[model samples]
Target: MYTLAVCAEMVFRDRPVPERAERIHEAGFEVEIWGWTRHDLDALARTPAHFSSMTGYIRGTLTDEDGAAELLRTAEQSVRAAEQLSCPRLNLHGTGLDDKGLPVVPVAGEADGPNWIAAHRTLTRIAELGESAGVVFTLENLNTAVDHPGVPFARAADTLALVAAVDRPGLRMNLDLYHAQIGEGNLIELVRRAHGLGLIGEIQIADVPGRCEPGTGEISYPAIARVLADLGYDGTVAMEAWASGDDDLALERFRSAFTL
Candidate 1:
């Protein structure tokens, strides 16, 4: 019941998306795309037959008001692709503290409560639009220490609260274990708590320190895996680790770790 999403940047290895899709299928896994754009339409157009197997599409950003609306439109297009391809989910990143390289607001500390409210409002609007497009919108949490150093809402509790505030049936979260480890040490407990709140919709995993494959870090992924199975987490378990030059070796490393 687990699947992997290939980040276009890591899998770019000079191979095209269609080739990546073929490789993923050959590896006995369904495919989720990290990022796709209009420019990719040409490469994607050539593989209409393979598109129906996509698990989900991760949309990058939609900061401004119009940009958010445009993202909804894009999600519509992605949903068409997903339905044609039989994909189930669409992941999204929230707005940052600023747009156009200027600080308009912040969403981290108590002082930025109003800013966070505005940001979540934007997220709610986007989520509604996504529902209209027939795609589930899941927010991804980024670790400020490793990646996405700006803005706020780094903690899983806070992100869960944002999802709660949004309160849309289709709005959910893409919980990244690496970022959760860096931002919140008690990842399993947090996962359990989020599950109790019915917030987590999808999950991704990678070890911290180097963002390498699982078992490369201090996190007890086997225990975490047990927790996930017990929680009845039926969503895709994407291996969102960084490329270590050899994908086959990395996949084997992850498979061994998880299986053992």
Candidate 2:
């Protein structure tokens, strides 16, 4: 059976974490993936025992070779927090990127040899931490055109490459069609390719013109859903939508389009 996870960022709307959790529960979603520590997670954890997952990051203080050790340490802490709340998965962003739109490096010419080595070491450490925690970590593909410019893993190939470098059983890719379509065309083809490489862990969608809701704009979501069903993908098809107007109306429209 395919499952659905709502990104709390889509539904919370700056509300209190407890209110967000109650709303999510009321909406009938059992599992969720929340954003970085931008909300009152402690209170949210107090919600009824439901399957949940959290998104976190390795601190920037852990980017160097000496810092790589702390990458796994912080990842372990994230895992501990998840386990405390019975969360099984932890979504991650790559080092070449930042989730909060903060620039990490100065305008460099290009990713040279030293850069690659440092990045690989940190990724490897993160994978080790994830494996040890028995908590799968996924590198999400961000929309470089609008949501995330200049971030690595903006391209599907780059995401695939990072997974390759991480090279761990616990490492995978959070395949967001919105970002993939924004950075690269041919969403179905990319899904097939990633499946062939055994890298896809989660899938998400929204339209192009506006990330309002699924099928609200130019995205052919039914075709993508067909591909997902055809591939027998046993993973979550998360709804990463924005509901600025009527949230329920947008959700209903998304449900109609994503009906499988």
Candidate 3:
């Protein structure tokens, strides 16, 4: 059976992050967070919630010299924070995102050959860092059409290719289906391909259009859940969505969708 979790940053808007984590733990699910630098790690550590993953770097881009150096520097810091929370996985992106979730350095189109080479070298160093730190680093896929435009390697296929090229145990794909559905269809096949390669570290979900809990929009999460089960994907499937209604009810809906 796959483990279930919720992104505390998206839900429980009324409480502090630690309090939200506690609430999620009490509600029978693990917790996920965004940037660790914004929260009190001591307070979060006191809570009983088991962390799934957190942002791996504070500031850096994957395809530049200065940005890659900053990325590695902050990644080491993130690894220490993960140790404080006992988080096993740290999430990364193609580049640093600003407060508004836009890329700090936006690319005009697909990454060129030089960009790809630089990104691979940076991720290879990141993999070494993860191996030394004893934590896995996941590269997440984002949709350029809607949420994160101008971000290089934002597509699931791009992320998969990068991770596979590195072919390191310390690096894996975050595999966000919400972005995949927006950027590319054929969700089932994507899941199969990623899982078949044994390169997925975690799976994130949200309904299309509204970005809310399951059953509130178009994606058939239950069917995807069944596919995951069929593939014996004994990993984490986290709800990185907002509550369309009450938070508890939204969590229940999320659980129900993946209950198989």
Candidate 4:
């Protein structure tokens, strides 16, 4: 069965930070955090929770202006966070585009530029930095049409292409199923493809139609989990879903859904 890590930002929004960590272990799951601050880090230190992964915005897009430099800076900062928090991976977004598919951080008024080249250069540098520091960089695709509209690189195929181009052992893609179901179908095939190529670094689960816990929407998470298990996917598959009922109940339901 796939392992589960709870996104503190999504389900534990109302709880205190330290208690959030405790609640995750209480429910028998690892903890995943977002946008952590000094207070959050200090509070996290006192907990016995295992931080599986961390994700947030970096200064630049993967293909926008100052993209490579900003990604490098974020990589440097991520290593420090990883060392302290014990989370070895940093998942981040690409330089976003507009509705018409242009860069959010344009260079001289240009939006769309050479996609593969920019991704290769930016990710390669970040990979080099992270490789030495015992951290890894992951590129995640989000649904722009739904919850995360307007961001480019919101497709599983796009991330696959980036991983092929970058060709770094320390660089990979985060297959977020909720967003992929919204923006790209063929979830099982995509997972198979990524697994075959060794490009999937992590997996995030939530049902489509709504970013709530599994079984609340059209997606069948049991089938998805079985597919991963059949393929020998031993990586972390975190539940980044929002809570629709009691948080404990929701966590229990999620754990059961992904149970092998």
Tell me, by TM-score, which candidate is best: 3
Q: Candidate 2: TM-score?
A: 0.87
Better of 3 and 4 by TM-score: 3
RMSD of each: 4.2, 2.6, 0.5, 3.4
Model 2: number of backbone collisions? 0
lDDT (tens digit, per residue) of candidate 4 on 164-189:
78888788888999888998888999
TM-scores, each model vs. reference: 0.80, 0.87, 0.99, 0.90
Alpha carbon lDDT of residue 141, candidate 2? Answer: 74
**Residue 150 alpha-carbon offset, candidate 1, angstroms:** 0.8
Per-residue lDDT of candidate 1, residues 50-153 (tens digit): 33123233232334465456556666666776665555677665542333322233335432666566667777776776677666777777676656665456
Clashes of each: 1, 0, 0, 5
lDDT of 3: 0.97
Ranking by lDDT: 3, 4, 2, 1
Output the worst ten-in-a-row residue range by lDDT, candidate 2.
102-111
Model 1: which residue pairs collide? 52-85
Q: Flag the better candidate by lDDT, 1 or 4.
A: 4
lDDT of 2 by residue, 1-260 (tens): 55666665676677765676677667766546565456555776787736545774545422366545655666777787787677777876544345565435322233556666776677677677778878787777776568765554446677777787777878888888888787787988998988888888777777886777875677888787778778878777777778757666666676666567
Model 3 weakest lDDT span, ten residues long: 209-218
